[model samples]
Target: MIRAARILFKATLWFVVLSVLWVGLYALVPPPFTLTMAGDLFQGRSITKDWTPLADIDPDMPRAAIAGEDARFCLHHGFDWRAIAGAAARNAQGRRIRGGSTISQQTAKNAFLWQGGGYLRKALEAWFTTLIELIWGKRRIMEVYLNLAETGIGTYGVEAGSIRYFDHSAARLTPTEAGRIAAVLPLPKKRAAIDPRGFVRRHGNAIAARVGVVRRQGLDACLK
Candidate 1:
């Protein structure tokens, strides 16, 4: 029993040390690829990605993303309690299991955790989200999230999405174009940002309006 306890303690210590070092390293350097990217490659899906700095990406891209995914992104410190509470209440009423994950949480999941819904994944995502909020700050968190998010089936990042969908550089995307990209974020594989129609078109328009609102209200001032 004592020997088993010693092994468990040593394993726990190593896990903590490694996790800290990993997060610290990523806080400084951009990750070359994510687990999702690797999984796609392993599954024989052609991955298309171009890593672009936040400065190189159009300013509207981040605004649209924040507007669509997490309106209170800059206000929260990794988690948005109000959104969580609302989602929980809705779920308890037998509604769809919509998530209230903020951009920070999404970044943590995309960068470190695998794609899926589970308690263990949520716990790890929460831990990494807190670490990033403490170390990477709002700007870096948005930067990483923009670059790592799956924009389409086998397409990753704004750069790739821009080139594939709009035939333009990410830095040159207009607000409408950026909004369209943001619109498909929830179900990228099933939506197209270039020639959005029906629901996507309307949703993209809404996100574009919210982008303006966020800009005027300084909702993302923390990134500045």
Candidate 2:
């Protein structure tokens, strides 16, 4: 029993160390690389990695993002405990399906972590999420999200997604088009902004509906 206890303690210690190290690294580094992507490369996969400041980005980008990724983004510093608790309870009752990771959490996972949906990855995600919240402010987090989000397998960032989906820059995306882009974030591969299918249309409508809600509720309310 004593030996088992020692092994467990060592494991716990190692995880804690790794968590601290990752957060410290995030605070120090800008972004390890312009692109930390995975999977097979494809045509038209080049990244336009201009370090545009947060202000340069369209307000609708973060607006829709907050609406889609974490409606409570402005209210939460980083983690949304209510959503996390709900996800935990839901996952516990079943085969452990879905998570309540916020936009900040997803950003950390995308930028610094891997793609696996494992418990280990989730724990690491939470650690990095907290790190990003503490190290980077709301503006920095949104800026990073715009740059790192995967619109396609090899394509990344709002600019890339905009170009790929609509053959235009993210700066030029219209409200209707932006809603379409935001709708498929959950299942990007299965949906597209240009798809004539009813599913895409329906999703666009749903996103459009929430656009006003997000605006009227005030963008900052999502931070909690």
**Best candidate according to lDDT:** 1
Off by over 4 Å in 2: 1-36, 41-51, 88-97, 221-224
- Mark the regions of model 1 whose C-alpha exceeds 4 Å error after superposition: none
Could you tell me which 10 consecutive residues in candidate 1 have the lowest summed lDDT? 15-24
Instruction: Report the lDDT tens digits of candidate 2 across residue range 50-162.
Output: 34555666667677777677888877867899998998899889965877878898888877787768888888777788887877767678878777776655556777778
Question: After best superposition, candidate 1 residue 146: deviation in angstroms?
Answer: 0.5
For model 2, the local distance difference test gives 0.71
* Total colliding residue pairs, candidate 2: 12
Cα deviation in Å at residue 5, candidate 2?
A: 12
lDDT of 1 by residue, 1-224 (tens): 99999999999899778888888898889988899998889989999988888989998999999999999998989999999999999999999888888999999999998998999999989988988898889999998998899999999999999999989899998889999999988888899998799999999999988888889999888878
lDDT of each: 0.91, 0.71
